[model samples]
Target: GGIITQTPKFLIGQEGQKLTLKCQQNFNHDTMYWYRQDSGKGLRLIYYSITENDLQKGDLSEGYDASREKKSSFSLTVTSAQKNEMAVFLCASSMAKQDTQYFGPGTRLLVL
Candidate 1:
């Protein structure tokens, strides 16, 4: 299968700079999502896409950018990396309310 979820284990974000994280899934799922988790807190939805080229903002979507141009790919970008924004970014895919989502290993963002 061409299904693989990968990103740099750790991304160093320069202050006030834009940081991008990439994710790819080949599960043929129709929905892809992005979430942010702080040190000891719960995961908060950042963004989600129901189909190719369709983007929906989630509760914590401010200060972030996301794209879903292809069925198997999606990208998330932090508009402005800040010192207080260090967190884990998680990506997942599912069949839009029909199946459980499969989450990819999280990518840590270390804003310096």
Candidate 2:
């Protein structure tokens, strides 16, 4: 019930190309989410799933994001395209709503 702001959102990949960011957690948490962070700002939620197949969109959920086929993993896809695919993709899981969240390492993409 609060406003989320993203200062200059990032694009992930070229137009019409699949860019997938995968996440896996071992704690078997019930809730998982994807977020992006900027050096000067705070974490911004992109998308999240409460359980296996339940998805909810965040402010930046313009692309495809999902809970994985297995409960231990989750995926955030800037799917079949974006003008530019760059953002710090952080995956976090919690045992219950707003409980302590354990975060996976942020993902960085490189293209030459």
Candidate 3:
């Protein structure tokens, strides 16, 4: 059994600033993903990595970048912080696209 941890549980950023978020998993899964959950919206994919050094952009990847440094870690960087309300960013991992995914608690970010 393994765990996933996200750094800086709460992130405060200025408008137009670029912020980076980190995620580390010990599950050694084959796939990792970054997702954004807005105030009143469902989860939207930002990016995903199928393996080490692989990056795939998602529907919401316009404002974000992601990296899979190793089999156990995946990170994301926000290109530009917007004036949107608070939201939670979730990290997930799966054996494959068709397999069940496990999610991390989330990183809450607020743009002031």
Clashes of each: 0, 5, 0
- Model 3: colliding residue pairs: none
Strongest candidate by lDDT: 3
Candidate 1, residues 25-107, lDDT tens digits: the string is 98888899999989788999999999999999999999999999798999999999998568889999998867788898989
Between candidates 1 and 3, the one scoring higher on lDDT is 3
TM-score to true structure, per model: 0.92, 0.75, 0.94
Ranked by lDDT from best down, the candidates are 3, 1, 2
Q: Write the per-residue lDDT of candidate 2 for residues 19-86, one digit (tens) a residue.
A: 77777777878888888776666898988888887888988777665655666667777665545444
lDDT tens digits, residue span 51-104, model 3:
899999899899788878898889999888988648999999988888988998
Clashing pairs in 1: none
RMSD of 2: 7.5
Predictions in order: lDDT: 0.89, 0.68, 0.90
Q: Candidate 2: lDDT over CA atoms?
A: 0.68
Output the TM-score of candidate 3. 0.94
RMSD to the true structure for each prediction, in A, is: 1.5, 7.5, 1.1
Q: What RMSD value applies to candidate 3? A: 1.1
lDDT of 3: 0.90
